[model samples]
Target: MAPWLIAAILTQGALALGLLWYLGTIRIPMVMRGEVRIDDIALERKGWPKREWQASNAFDNQFQLPVLFYVGAGLALYFGPTSLEVALAWLFVVTRYAHAFVHITDNHVIRRFAAYFAGLLLLCLFWLDLAVRLVLSL
Candidate 1:
């Protein structure tokens, strides 16, 4: 795996952590208080939807997939990475962050689809890489 790939992973991982930190410390309470903030950073001005403890569950749904992807990517770097694999691994993180942003802040069509498809593609690539490597080694 390339060093730049590691850097990409680290950058996305940091952003994900930042998102979690903000959510736990900020969004959770706001949700508990039935608050939704305007998403001015987004192309649209609509606020996040009303959420309760369901917000926490939503966080879990959002966070869980990427964490697994991160672990898989880390192992690939530690073991080996085809250039294509590294690229896809990096894409996974970028899309995960985008997905999270779409999921939590701005629920728009393009952003939501970009997040979902990117993640699904990466996950497929991750599994394919692992499967082929295992088969070839055998």
Candidate 2:
């Protein structure tokens, strides 16, 4: 509802679009062509189709999940700032980056699962927050 909140949501949307672009231009292409190892520049230095590249795709996917969340949360905020929705929005951003980190460095099951859980939790929160807003408004 507030202009600042809308701006924040817009930024979040842009971030999501950036992730989508990364997926389309980079991930999908590399996956399709079987060109691994990040970029050909990396390949020039080393080789191709490395696990890191795959991990990067996964990382981006993880980050993308939050985009939907912020959009939802932002809409909810237009109604009012319930801690629930704001908290969920924050969680969405955190989990996304955490997922990216785990994919990049840790690459552990626990970390991955936490990231997944966080994302799913945020997704659930979006609807719950929205529902509350609707019910309360009515």
Candidate 3:
């Protein structure tokens, strides 16, 4: 993989790590203080505070569309990534960060959706670029 592509992937990984840290910071204390129950949370995350829930949901979101990002990245690495692919990768990372911000902070559905959609579009473009490259090479 190119250094730039690795950097983009690392940045996305950092975002996920940061969200995990944030969730733990919020949730561990709540459990310690009896603010929430482990059993309750274990069963579909019931009784979690709104803030914790949002953070958790944002963390969970990382595994969804970003899975595609990882797969696309692997393909890009194998096929040799173009500058456009690198740019799209970085842009998708930015959009995911934006989506997480809106989801955990204000919890605004429209804003979150816009960010998510933007990331999705970027991911699609990245895959499309890879597909075209592969077809052309063949």
Candidate 4:
């Protein structure tokens, strides 16, 4: 496996940790204090804690955009990794981390979207490279 592949997997784990920490900080106290019932936070119409919701949303965002990343990285492993591909992979992961950071912090939309768009551009580069490789191989 490429070093970038390993880094990508570790990045996913890091994102998971962020989600766990944020949500746990909120839910654990509620449970321990018995301030709310299961249905209160679970099924009821009550809104979630803002930061916790942001964390959860960020976590969901991971699965969506990063699926392309996983595929691109896996293909790169099979095709043999290029330095450019590896660099772009790292860029995507770094931007995603930034996006999550912005989300859980002040969540300035412009900053978050900037990071998100940068990742998308990186993803597109990965795809474009794959396409070129495919055409060249034929």
Candidate 5:
């Protein structure tokens, strides 16, 4: 596997750790304080403390956009990208970390969107790179 793919996996692991950290530190307190019941932990509900809620939402965001990232990394590893592609992959991971930070902190929409869009652009670059390689090879 490519080093970039390993970094991408680690990025996903970091996001999962964020979710776990929130569940243990934030959600557990809400449950203890009676702000949220154990039953209320159901995904169908949205009754968490503000920061905890944001953490949960940010965690959910991981599953959404990062799926594309995982796919891109897998394809990149398989296709063998240039060094620039590897750097872009790392940039995408860093942008996700930034997005999560903004989301779980001030909940700043514009900052989060900036990070999100930057990552989106990186993902598009990955796809474009793959397409160009495929075209040149054929």
Candidate 6:
């Protein structure tokens, strides 16, 4: 795997770990203290406080777009990636971090959408780069 790719992947993993820590340490304790109903969370987290809900939602967001990221990373590892792909991957990670920050902090819809859209564009470019490379090679 490219070193830049590895660094980007590790950075994303660290973000996930941070979110998991928030969920486990803060959010779960809220349930233990009867601040929120376990049943509510089990159903759809309808009763969760805004802060807790935002944290949970941010955590969930990781698995969504990042799934494609992992797939693209794996393909890049297998097929070898160029600087363009690596740069796009890093940019995508940056957007994800920005999105999570906006989501968990202020819950700003416009900022979050901007970050998400930028990341989506970067991911599309990364995939297109890979596809073009594969086609050219064959």
Q: What TM-score goes with each of the models?
A: 0.66, 0.59, 0.96, 0.87, 0.87, 0.92
- Please give the range of 10 consecutive residues that has the lowest summed lDDT in model 1: 49-58
lDDT of 6 by residue, 1-138 (tens): 398898998898888888978878767788889988888778676888888878888999999999899899878978877788788889999999999999889988999999999999999998888888789889
Query: Ranking under lDDT, best-scoring first?
Result: 3, 6, 4, 5, 1, 2
Q: Per-prediction count of colliding residue pairs?
A: 0, 4, 0, 0, 0, 0
TM-score-superior candidate, 2 or 6: 6
Name the TM-score of candidate 6: 0.92
Across residues 1-138, which tens digit of lDDT does each residue of candidate 5 receive?
Answer: 487567766877688686778757987777778988867667655666677778887888888778887887777778875787788788888888999889888989999999999999988988788888889989
User: Residue 85, candidate 5: how far off, in angstroms?
Assistant: 1.4
lDDT of 2 by residue, 22-128 (tens): 54575567556776545654435344344545454664674456656665766776677666666666566667666666665657879778887877887787778
Q: Please give the TM-score that candidate 1 achieves against the real structure.
A: 0.66
Candidate 3 lDDT trough over 10 residues, lowest sum: 37-46
Native-referenced Cα lDDT, model 6: 0.88
lDDT of 6 at 1: 38
State the displacement of the C-alpha of residue 135, model 5, in Å, after optimal TM-score superposition: 1.9
List where candidate 4 sits over 4 angstroms from the true fold.
44-46
C-alpha-based local distance difference test score of model 5: 0.80
Candidate 4 lDDT tens digits, 1-138:
488676775786688677777767876786677765666777742645566677777777888888888888888888888888888888888898999889878889999999999999989998899889878989
Cα lDDT, all candidates? 0.67, 0.63, 0.94, 0.81, 0.80, 0.88
Model 3 lDDT, residue 54, Cα: 97
**Which one wins by TM-score: 3 or 4?**
3
Mind giving the per-residue lDDT tens digits that candidate 1 earns over 1-138?
568668767876686666667667765575456575434314642454344233333356556776667677776776676787778877877787777666666457697787878788887888688777878889
Kindly report which residue stretches of model 1 are placed more than 4 angstroms away from their true locations once superposed. Answer: 24-58
Which residue pairs collide, candidate 2?
1-78, 36-49, 37-49, 37-50
